[model samples]
Target: MNGDTAALPPHRPGSTPAGTTDTSHIVQGTPAFRRTAAALFLAGFSTFGLLYTVQPLLPEFSRHFGVSAANSALALSLSTGLLAVSMLIAGLLSDRIGRRRVMVAALLASSVLSLATAMVDDWSTLLVLRTLLGIALSGVPAVGMTYLAEEMDSRALGLAMGLYIGGNAIGGMSGRLIAGIVADHWGWRWGIGVVSLIAVASTLLLWVQLPPSRHFQSRRSGLRELPARWRSLFADPGLPLLFATAFVLMGVFVTLYNYLGYHLMAPPYGLSQTVVGLIFSVYLVGTFSSAWMGQQANRYGRSRVLGICYGLIALGIALLALPWLGCMAAGIALVTFGFFGGHSVASSWVGSRAGAMRADASALYLFAYYLGSSVAGVLGGVFYTHWDWLGVCGFVGVLTVAGAAVAWRLGRRTQPATGELALSR
Candidate 1:
């Protein structure tokens, strides 16, 4: 072989080979990319579908298991609590092992735990299973954001991320709906069994359909690296804001959802669990809002879109204070849409703002995201007990306003913003 033709120049880091079109059908928009998106969508759908499946079945759990309101709600609270704690480790694990493997393992294990939860006879055992499932479920969100950041081209990241989130919106809607309707007809056990079965199938589909990560470069793992990564990201001003935004926004969103079921089930409303559960079908609005808002954020600035979304969230939460069911549903829908749209923008902002330490930054943001869920979520119980739905709305609505205020500050800050924060708006 003649040495006349020289070896190709080393490709630039973060640069794909020139003129190679990303034609994957599994991604977003493109046919090739659609399949990829679908796989992750299912992964998103199933993880959340199974994760929050028990939320609407709380009333049935109370009656069957002989527990109180807060205890019945423990099924979801315990899972989110454990999920928040596991995310830190899951992100680090993905950085070392690759996103696909970690995500696949997490989904499958969570599905198995859901199956176990379905069979448990004791309420204590059920909580333990939910917590275990939550721990297993951490693999998805911790790694999914990192995967999107690295795998998708910068030009395509927002749309791709939105589609993955669309999957989440639908999953959250369908999970509660199915659990409530089925539990109403048959029983809570059947409800759990059905969702768990779907999760098992979805796990297989995620593993089989999602492509292996070609862009990921596994990192060197160590405890020292964790602190170093944490410090490095914290040193970046943009990251701390992103992390805090995740915490506050998520806390507010979960708190509203955590107690909404209780409010609808009580005196004034006195709605059947199935009817109340169907209200969560409004989460479909999030699917539409996320995709459209993401596209607009890509065109405009993410910070700008995010502030508007948060404002909408505040307005919606305030409106829910009204007595009419129609107004309440509308308000919930607005808040749901705003939450998804804002999350889509902010979460992507974290990836764009962090520069080369993207995975670490994403993980930290999610760590805050889950911690908010676990902490504010349980604390929300106090508000519920003392003040009822009005109290819950006030607490959550204020957090939304605070989140918007932070985003406003981040949006207005001056230049010389180091790293990806300075990337083209």
Candidate 2:
């Protein structure tokens, strides 16, 4: 289930009224399209930028909190862990309320929490605020995907999704880079404060510019109706494997990044924090790869394209195990490129396969995705402490191999023996 499987879901007969006006689809080259795309881009930026603001500050956290690398990682891990669980509920909540309202409130509330996080002196209090930020963020990502799937023209949907993900890549990069550099000059709190202020602007753009949802009709289904839809989503042939891919992919990526700062800061490469921050600019490659690879998947098949990406991820991990700085940078860039490309393809695949349950499918994928980040990210620190970079690489390597195996199985199931071809809508 790939390629033209990216097509939109058909309208339910009794649900949408006659003469409701077919102005729902915001196709390319229209004013509504421009506004909606820009608004979502800002939404993507705010959500990720706020969430990852503390990533590069991990070492500083260890120093200040007097904690081990594993303990310091809790700042990000706990947030992601909570965010993953909240996503399950947030999607269903959006079904009851409207998409636009949930997204706007999520952004605004999360931004405020981020700002508050900068001021807390108590370590426990800081963690509490970070946890809340995760719950607040749950409203945006899954709902945003559902909103785009509902409102955008089928032909232009791929590009719309790519742009939003590109925004995520840039936001993640900028947050890490800016925080590291600023922290080196001033303090970690100041670094976090700056990123929060930027997120405030991003929130305003999403609130003011996003066109209200014309396509979303409120679903009155309560908690009782969720189990049936959950069963349907899991039973789909393509979706379960895709969710596993999400978990493994994020696990590998976050594990490497979570500990790389520590490795680069110690003995052989005692790089300054600012320089360390500059290295995360590798995310620019991801910004380009996601859009480009998504286009390739549209022409070729997602299954064929995705396996190659998994191979690239493994190759990158191998490079990181080497002892050269240049080699490490190259490895990180490769990993970033492959990660964004595979994520773009796989995430779009979930929407394609879900039919009408776009929000639930997206929520499931993100839930696994963030869960991997929380679990594997913290585990990486333990490996680093015991056996250094080799152990860390070994852990990530195993996950990548498993991801490749799953990708191969998915490809075989989705493609015919005659030739690889796009799935019909």
User: Which pairs of residues collide in model 2?
Assistant: none
Local distance difference test, candidate 1: 0.80
Candidate 2: list runs displaced more than 4 Å.
Answer: 1-23, 415-421
lDDT leader: 2
- lDDT of candidate 1 over 79-165, digit per residue (tens): 887887788888778877778888888998888889888888899999999999989999998688877776666667888889888
Cα RMSD of predicted structure 1: 4.6
Instruction: Report model 1's TM-score to 2 decimal places.
Output: 0.92
Which ten contiguous residues of candidate 2 have the minimum total lDDT? Answer: 416-425
Error of 2 at 59 (Å): 0.5
> Model 1: runs farther than 4 Å from truth?
1-29, 414-425
Candidate 2 TM-score, true structure as reference: 0.93
Give the distance in Å from residue 225's predicted Cα in candidate 1 to where it truly belongs.
1.6
Clashes of 2: 0
**Could you tell me every candidate's TM-score relative to the true structure?**
0.92, 0.93
Against the reference, the lDDT scores of all candidates come to 0.80, 0.85
